[model samples]
Target: MATLKQVARWVPSHWGAGHLVLAGFLALLVLAVSPVIKLDLVVNGLFLGAIIGLGAIGLSLVYGILKFAHIGHGDFMTLGAYFALFLLSDLFPRIGLTGAGLGPFTFGYPLLLALPLAMLAMAVVAIALDLGIYRRLRRRGVNPVVLAMASLGVAIALRGVVQIFWGGGTEQYPRVSKLFYRLPMDVRIPPDNLFVGGLTVVLVVALYLFLTRSKMGKAMRATSDNPDLARVSGINTEHILWWTWAIGGALAATAGVLLAVSQAQLVPIMGWRLLIPLFAAVILGGIGNPFGALVGGLIIGVTSEISTQWLNPSYKPAMAFLVMIIMLLFRPRGLFGAKD
Candidate 1:
């Protein structure tokens, strides 16, 4: 508890206050809605939050280390989803491994196999983008705005590729419906939702362990704190950068897959549409703090879901934007951000 308090002191009071306000608002909202409905919305929001948190972690990591807005990150997520689609529906079928559903689950062995491969492919793609484009720009000492613009171009190209290959229509993973389990509070939830929530927890814990216990993770943290100092201190900054993209890309892939699973459909613009909420999560959490991103994601998700009671469901992204603006007005540094 003492250690936690000391860490809390690093954040500005205004940010903490803003969080309190948000929390109070949410509590009031819960009171306004019926108990059963509120519980349902909150549970669904958590499933959504898990996906957003995974994506936000990657965004935070890239920004922390690379210091540029990765506009193409969302498209990379789209690409990862498509990769899984291809593997699960196309390649595996040919190899006589159908994407059969496991007991009480929508996915089976093929998905389990395709997931890691998709993550690996996405990681490689991220590295290649760095080596082919961003690295060259960095070497030339281009401004961050230019890098951001370049990423925008990459984003366009990636979306185009998806459109060309998959068409502009929606896609879905091969699967069947799973029965919802009734909980103690009469809350019924799908198995896939439980899977997403559990996997997210595991990933977050693994990330925490990696950041605190592993040498490479420590190097990444040092690089994020001060790249020049880390380089001078015998840390291989370039290698750290590569690992950053690799980890970020893998996480993005996982988020994309989970989103597809939860939503049961995919569109070419799925990732692009998600980009706004993702940015909201990142900004609300803190620009470069991964854990902050996770917290921000949950807040945004819950708020968006609860708002549907009064607002149009399509306004979900707007809820995130509104929350972000509100937070910034009180605390631009975000909940866990330290002073510059």
Candidate 2:
């Protein structure tokens, strides 16, 4: 009741009014379809959201801090999964650990062990890209449009490199065929999906705490607020930038591995397809707000699944695009974005 009253008392400014409108929309949606909300839709939406949200965190951070849209971030997702796949395929079994994932997951212990290495590798790759390309451009004082265009070119080159190494055909994890379980409400929950979702929650919580409480995390936020101000205040903006890539790259890698586990297949172009939705999520959540990624991801994910009821399932990918368009139409700053 206290929370309800507090919410009721929120002043309806341009920024706050959007919140109330969004909340009202949700309330009306619940009231209208209280009965037909399928458990599967909820379950699927959650893990899918988890996957997208995890990756979006990285993309959001890069955009917020560096002020450039990283078109190559999605490629990190594909590369990370490939890294895990390379290690876990026959090498793990050769070293004597089989691909029998803990208790029913299609992903195995060896793959889990490979996760950190993939993260580290991806982080190194991110920083290297910064040094190799972005740093030089910034030093030359090029506009952000130039940076964005360069990233798009880099993304295409990266995609081609991945295709050359991993090949175009889809590849599966060391061949695990297990029975996926469905709950009482006709809700099917895969073991790997549950694990990924749980991990995402934990990471998000840790990130929130870190950003709010830790020194470096707060510095990152400060840099995002004003790089010039942060530099004048004794904060090393360059260090913060490097660390941003490290964290974002690590998270992107993990999201990729989790996505592979869920689909039971890996392909070079998989992450490419997921990029549009990720961009949508980042925009919907607001360009620089990490928490908004969580909220936006859930809305986008659940809406994509549930939208199938009204539109064709084949159009599911367009749901994020539609949401982004609507957001741009009304609340251009996004749900959590600070009002100008």
Candidate 3:
């Protein structure tokens, strides 16, 4: 192992120091652009950030624990949305609940009910995918790149299945009139936006508490930090894997549902389109750091939205792409990336 002094010396020489420079630049840029940035855009950006963060958390967790890039994660989001749609539109109607509106929200109680069920269902699917595909590959000692490529195939398969079943058109939950709440700076936000942001905060807090205070959660952290050491310490890495997938899948489902509600529509490719931003957040936040994902998501969302001032709104995703490229070039480890 390297000495403390050597490691300390290495830090300044590596890309780690670049992140500090990047941070300073970002701060300066924000200051320069603050006056032009509208409050409504910021509010919309937060809502977008919540969605991106939610998805990125799961992706980060999976990557952290499993040490592989999961390209199927975005498609999993699509699956979750479709699963909730099935419950709300098909199942609930048969049960005498037409998913009527719940107060000022756009959807109904049935959707709230479907949310957890969809999460559970997605958890099962994630575990099944792991057992069926990823586990087999791991046993064969395939590389992480192979696993990532396999996930690409999985992504393609999932999207195809969705297109076949739901058709290639857009679909949405049962709709009610949306209500907006006005805040200062003449910003108007829908209840769904608040719901998305609030739920994201709750979930992030719950994840933090779980990781810090719970037994299994601690084991997960250990595994993420060093799986071999964790396994040698009598931790059941297998169980950790299961829990990671469960949480990841459930979070993906929640993000999908939230995105569907906020956007008022869902298409098979919606998650695919969002995948770049999600990865950008993960890379920007530090791969495998869930909290980093949250922070990165918010920054990406806000910057992407605010860039509309100068660039076409259609290029929002390009903004995320740009951030990712910059990080890859200057600070590949990201802001909160763990030192090796």
Q: Residues 247-295, candidate 2: write the lDDT tens digits.
A: 8889999999888888888889888888877888888788888888777
Error of 3 at 276 (Å): 0.7
Clashing pairs in 1: none
Give the worst 10-residue stretch by lDDT in candidate 1. 8-17
Worst 10 residues of 2 by lDDT: 4-13
> Cα deviation in Å at residue 93, candidate 1?
0.6
> What's the residue-level lDDT of 11 in candidate 2?
44
Candidate 2 ranges with C-alpha deviation above 4 Å? 1-33
TM-score of each: 0.91, 0.91, 0.91
**Candidate with best lDDT:** 3
RMSD (Cα, Å) of candidate 3? 4.6
- Each model's lDDT comes to 0.86, 0.82, 0.89
- The true-versus-predicted C-alpha distance at residue 167 of model 1, in Å, is 0.8
Candidate 3 residue runs with Cα over 4 Å from true position: 1-33
**lDDT order of candidates, best first?**
3, 1, 2
